[model samples]
Target: MNLYAIFAIYFLMWVISAFIMLPFGIRTPDETGEVLLKGQADSAPSNFRPGLVMLRATILATILFGLYYANYVQGWVTLDMLPGYSAAQ
Candidate 1:
């Protein structure tokens, strides 16, 4: 694929990875035994770290995108291989 296509696909993968990592490694103040700030939601995470989430998402997305690129180059899987897919006009 071209550079723009690769960049676009990788960006999509990164976004999906970020969303998948959002709920992991999170804890509410009550769960961590910390006092909640005024006006804070009850379920808000007291120790939320954007850096950690970004790091984890980057790693996950790299691995996933690597697999995707490999498949794209090798043609290991294709639309015709999927069940119920029809390539005819």
Candidate 2:
């Protein structure tokens, strides 16, 4: 695909990866036995590491996007391969 298409796809993949990675390696304030701030929720993470999360997300997204790109290039799967798909028009 073109550069713009690749970038768009990668951006989408990154966002998805970020969400999937959010819950991992997290410790809620209650779990860590830490005193919460006045407005902080009990469920808030004691050590919310945005940098680490982003790093993990980037790695995961890279791998996922690589696989997606490979599939796109190799045509390993296609719309016609779906169980109920009909190409007739």
Candidate 3:
């Protein structure tokens, strides 16, 4: 893949990883035995750590993208392997 394609894929992977990592390690105020601030939603996390989340997301995205890139280069799986796929022209 080209540089732009790789960058785009990595960016997409990072965003996906960020969202996938968001729900984990969250602590609602009720769960943490903390009083909710004014205008804070009941489900709002009391100990939300953006830095940790970003770090974890980066790591997970790197691993995921690495596997994807390897598969792309190795052709371990391909569209032709999917059921019902047809490449006839």
**8-78, model 2: which lDDT tens digit per residue?**
99999999999999999999978888888999888888888999999999999999999999999999998
Query: How close is each model in CA RMSD to the real structure?
Result: 0.9, 1.1, 1.0
Clash list (residue pairs), candidate 2: none
Total clashing pairs for each candidate: 0, 0, 0
TM agreement with the true structure for every prediction:
0.94, 0.92, 0.94
Q: In lDDT terms, how accurate is model 2?
A: 0.94
- 1-89 per-residue lDDT for model 1 (tens digits): 99999999999999999999999999999899989888999999888899999999999999999999999999999989989996874
Error of 2 at 36 (Å): 2.2
State the lDDT of candidate 3 residue by residue for 1-89, as single tens digits.
99999999999999999999999999899999999888989998888999999999999999999999999999999988888996663
lDDT of model 2, residue 32 = 85
Candidate 2 or 3, higher TM-score?
3
TM-score of 1: 0.94
